[model samples]
Target: MKKFFYILLVFTVLSSCSEYQKVLKSEDIATKFKMGEELYNEGKFAKANRLFAQIVPNYRGKPQAEKLMYLYSNSFYEMGDYYVAGYQFERFASSYPNSEKQEEASFLSAKSYSMLSPAYTKDQKQTVEAIEKLQTFINVFPESKYVADANTLVQELDFKLENKAYSIAKQYNLISDYEASIKSFNNFIFDFPGSSLREKALFYRLDSAYKLAMNSVERKKEARLNQAKEFYESFKKAYVNSEFISQADDMAVELNGALENYSTKS
Candidate 1:
């Protein structure tokens, strides 16, 4: 009985494969469309994508084009081909403005771009583009069910940009390029005032200023020390209980000791 059941299942699988191959090679668009949709519904997106691609241009401007294009665009998305999926879904949304699936297509198109965003350490062109796409989707579909998700993606991408900027500034500090580090951190603070990293930025900026002052020549040391003192005060005012408060106090002790010499000279 077990052997019989196994043979029956094997036969069924072979028959299905045979039929799929026959339909794939056949020149009949209707048959291809039927099989493609069946495969799509059964979660066989790869096979469905092949059949849909063959018939897509032929069905253009036809009554079934809208449905066919939607299926085609989604098959790419299902297969993780985000670049093509993004473009195709954008095309589908533009082509069928009144489609019941139009909103879904637009949202998915934006989502596909988001999926293509690389890590924060890499070049951030795609990250910026994804944020723009998601922002546009939110503006266009203010009441969409997907708006919240789109906003979340935008926030995530925005943070990636913020992280990249912050890292570059921190890198400058690590290399002992205190002047460049101070400039970069200043730009970062101004650009992303609401960044989650703002606290770190403020601390690091003060650290850079303090280091630069401590290393300056005798002629420039007094003025740079005064500037560093101002940075220390600003950081303390913003975050009295910061994690770096101990280190900050240590730096302040050295700064005050140096400033006292200048004060005595007056």
Candidate 2:
């Protein structure tokens, strides 16, 4: 009985495919639209897209154009071709500015771009684009139901950028490039004033300055040590009870002792 049922199912599928192929090659536009909508409703988006793509130009400026364009764009999204989905949805929204589907189309367009955001360690061009698109969506649709989701994606992308910058700065410290590390951390602090990594950035900046001072020539040593001492003081004031306080205190003592020894030698 099961074998009989399996054979019946296979036959039905083949029959449907045969009819679908016939529709694909037919010159009957209305039949194609109907079959495409049915295929889409059945989650057969690739086949539906093929049908829709054929008739879309023929139906342009007709009563069904807007709906056809929306479905066509969504087919790309459903297929996970996000770049094409983003472009197609953006086109639909612009082509039908007052469409009832406009808000959804715009949101999906930005969401598609967000899907293209690569890892935090990669080049951030797509991440920047995603943030800009999400921000634009929020500004245009302040009360949108998708606002919270859009905001979350923006925050995630922003943190990715922050982490990328922070990692690059920290790499300089790891490689003993004290001068570049100090400059990078300073720029990081200025750029991401509210970063959760601010304390760490400050700590590393102080460490870099100290290392740079210790390695400098006698004439430059005093000036660099003074700068390192200032960094230590600032860090202490900002993080009085921090876990790093003890380590920072040790660095301070080293800076002061070095300065005194240098002065004695002079």
Candidate 3:
């Protein structure tokens, strides 16, 4: 009985494949469209995608165009070809503004870009793009059912961008590029004021200033030391109970001592 059932299933699958091949090669657009939708509903996205591709051009300007394009873009998304899906969905959004699927297509287009965003260690161009796209979706469809999900995606992408910027600024400090590190960290703090990394960025900025003062030429030491002291004051004011408070205070003692020494000399 088991063997008989297995054979029957194989026969069924083979018969379906045969008919699908015939559909693929058929000149009739209507047949192709129907088969493509059926394949899509069956989760046979690759096959559905092929069928849709063949008839897409013919359906343009026809009543079926909008839905066909949406299904085509979604087929690529379901198959994990998100780069192509993002472009295709974006095209659908612009081409079919009156479509009932407009909000969904717009959201999916942004979500597809989010899929392309890499780890925080990588270049963040895609991450930035994802944030922008998701924000645009929110702005356009304020009450959309997908608004919450889109907002969540934007938050995640924003954090990734913040992490990348923080890492780059920290790297500058590690490489003894104190001047650049100070500038980078300052800019980072200004750009991402609400970032969880703000405390660390502030501490690092002052630390970098301290290091710069220590390494400065005799003519520049006093000025750099004064700048470091100002940075220490800012850190103390903002992060009074921070994990870095003790270390920052130690740096401050050294900065003030150095400043006093310079004062006595001048």
- Expressed as tens digits, the lDDT of each residue in 1-266 for candidate 3 is 99999999999999999999999999999999999999999999999999999999999999889889999999999999999999999999999998999899999999999999999998888898889888989999999999999988988889998999999999999999999999999889989999999999999999999999988999999999999999999999999999999999999888888888877986
Clashing pairs in 1: none
Clashes of 1: 0
Worst 10 residues of 2 by lDDT: 257-266
Query: Which ranges of candidate 1 are over 4 A from the true structure?
Result: none
| Residue 193 lDDT (model 3) | 93
* lDDT tens per residue, model 1, 1-266: 99999999999999999999999899999999999999999999999999999999899899999999999999999999999999999999999999999999999999999999999999999999999999999999999999999999999999999999999999999999999999999999999989999889989999999999999999999999998898899889989999999999999999999999999999
- The TM-score of candidate 2 is 0.94
lDDT of each: 0.96, 0.94, 0.94
Native-to-model Cα distance after best TM-score fit, residue 27 in candidate 2, in Å: 2.1
Clashes of each: 0, 0, 0
lDDT accuracy of residue 21 in candidate 2: 99
Cα-based RMSD of the predictions, in order? 1.1, 1.7, 1.5
Per-prediction TM-score: 0.97, 0.94, 0.95
Clashing pairs in 3: none
Please report the candidate that would top lDDT against the real structure.
1
